[model samples]
Target: MILELVRFLVFIFFVITSFMIILLVLFQDEQGDGIGGVFGGGSSSIFGARSSSVAIKITAFFITLFLFL
Candidate 1:
């Protein structure tokens, strides 16, 4: 039952994240501006635009999680 709950929560999280990703993509500027254009791109971007370690880490975590499930 606990495993099932985790799976269900993960499913909801994925669904919500998918929509958020789509919205963020749509908000980005096509020329060169990122979501930072709408938010703040130049001032606070710790990682560069393309090579974010955070993105890699999050992706790795999700992949491992999915596999474990």
Candidate 2:
């Protein structure tokens, strides 16, 4: 019973993480402007220049987690 519960939880986590990864990738800017450019490639950025690196790290983490799960 516990094993089944654990498996279900992991599956749920994997699905949620997958969606998060997709959204993160879609929201990020290809021109290195970070996610702030999704709305408008302007001089203003909500996450600043450092957001790109942060997003990359998060994406990597979720990908690794997905593989493991």
Candidate 3:
């Protein structure tokens, strides 16, 4: 029973992480001047400079989590 419960929890976590990764990928800017630019494209804007890096890292994290699960 304990093993089955653990498996089910892992499955849930995997599914959640998969969805998060997909969303992060979609939100990421393409060619450094895509959808992400529309919000704060200016170089002076902190988000414009850092969003891509943040998104990429988060996406990678979720992908790794999904794989581990």
Candidate lDDT (C-alpha), each: 0.53, 0.69, 0.67
Best by lDDT: 2
TM-score order of candidates, best first?
Answer: 3, 2, 1
Worst 10 residues of 3 by lDDT: 42-51
Best by TM-score: 3
Task: Look at candidate 1 and tell me the lDDT of residue 53.
Answer: 34
Clashes, model 3: 0
Tens-digit lDDT track of model 2 for 1-69? 999999999889989999988987787557655554544454433345634457755766777788888
Q: Over the stretch 1-69, how does candidate 1's per-residue lDDT look in tens digits? A: 999999999898877666655554455434454556324464324344653435433444454454564
| lDDT (10s digit) by residue, model 3, range 1-69 | 999999998888888888898898788766555544535653323334454366655666677787777
Model 1 residue 11 lDDT?
91
Native-referenced Cα lDDT, model 3: 0.67
TM-scores, one per candidate = 0.47, 0.63, 0.64
Worst 10 residues of 1 by lDDT: 37-46
- Model 3: residues >4 Å from true position, as ranges? 32-52
